[model samples]
Target: MKDGKRFPVVEENYRFECTLCGNCCTGDQRVWLNPADLMRMALFLGYGHTSELFRQNVVLLDEGENGAWRPRILFKSYKKLRFCPFLENHLDDRGRITGLCRLHPKYKPLICRLAPLGRVWDAETGSEQWLFVKPAPDCPGVNSSRLNSLRETLQQYGSEIEEETAFLKKLQHFLEMKSEPEAYQELFYFIVKRKGEGDKR
Candidate 1:
């Protein structure tokens, strides 16, 4: 009795309880920050407005086709690779990651909230889909007996999930229409370069 048009039967067996292992936080994947996230994070950090905090802590990704700026967390690296500045690999005396995000519980990115659920879009039909990311074979959370019902899981984080789905759909559509990776790269570079040039003058 499920609606096939909007709700396809997706596998919902996997359940997760975050051990705060921080594996996913240490990558170069795009970390999108929406307005709501920014506001909440700023408030949690006692900032009157998030604009300055966002600008200081985040970098703008390439502008979308609609010319809106997309923001992502920025990091400095010894090499050319990017990472999250808030991620730490070592534990402190108290056994917590030192110099890492103290506000992780409140300021995690929307994508971080939807971890283990990779969103993809079908280019031909423009439909969104979700797939589970099986944890590393050694992860302890994988063996937990607690399970979250599909409705409960969806309700807990639906807005962010929907936003991610929409973003993936748009990205997939663009990729399907684009001729080559270089073409998309050039487009992104052109947009970013133009903005930089404008700032210099």
Candidate 2:
């Protein structure tokens, strides 16, 4: 429970399997990225700097909540289409236009790796709970015969998820201590310097 309210928590036996229909890649869904994500993407693309990543593929989203506004980093969709920039569409054997992500299976953002499931953690209590990210009505990956445990899903990222989670907790704490503008600048430089120091793992 958070703020004296209970949230629906997903169980361990939650089952899901991606059919790779590409529905998730076609929407205006925002895939927020952490510093770790930036590092991975930079390493994958062989870029020494992240400025081009922002200029080409990512954007600073002006997110607001409860009269508070902050700049969060997330991927940008194509200018003409409301789909991921990396998303490719091609006709399958069945004559269906299937969506394929160039960065899938590896180099994907953490949220993309944990699609259909989202986590909420309390900074004070250090407790985390998983919730179902509402999928599209016709999404075929919701409940399939192939079962996947929540632990297994998270384990797909191995130790990276743990590191990302820890970093997020610390970042959240830092944000609360500083003003929005200060926090944004600090966060940007921290990510650049932290990743620039050969922290790619």
Q: What is the TM-score of each candidate against the true structure?
A: 0.54, 0.77
Among the numbered candidates, top TM-score falls to 2
**Candidate 2 RMSD computed on C-alpha atoms after optimal superposition onto the true structure:** 4.4
For all candidates in order, the CA lDDT equals: 0.54, 0.65
Q: Which window of ten consecutive residues has the lowest lDDT sum in model 2?
A: 64-73
Cα RMSDs, all models:
9.2, 4.4
Candidate 2: tens digits of C-alpha lDDT, residues 33-111: 6666766676667766555565554545354432223334454445665766667788989998887887776777777
RMSD of model 1, in Å?
A: 9.2
Stretch of 10 with least lDDT, candidate 1: 186-195
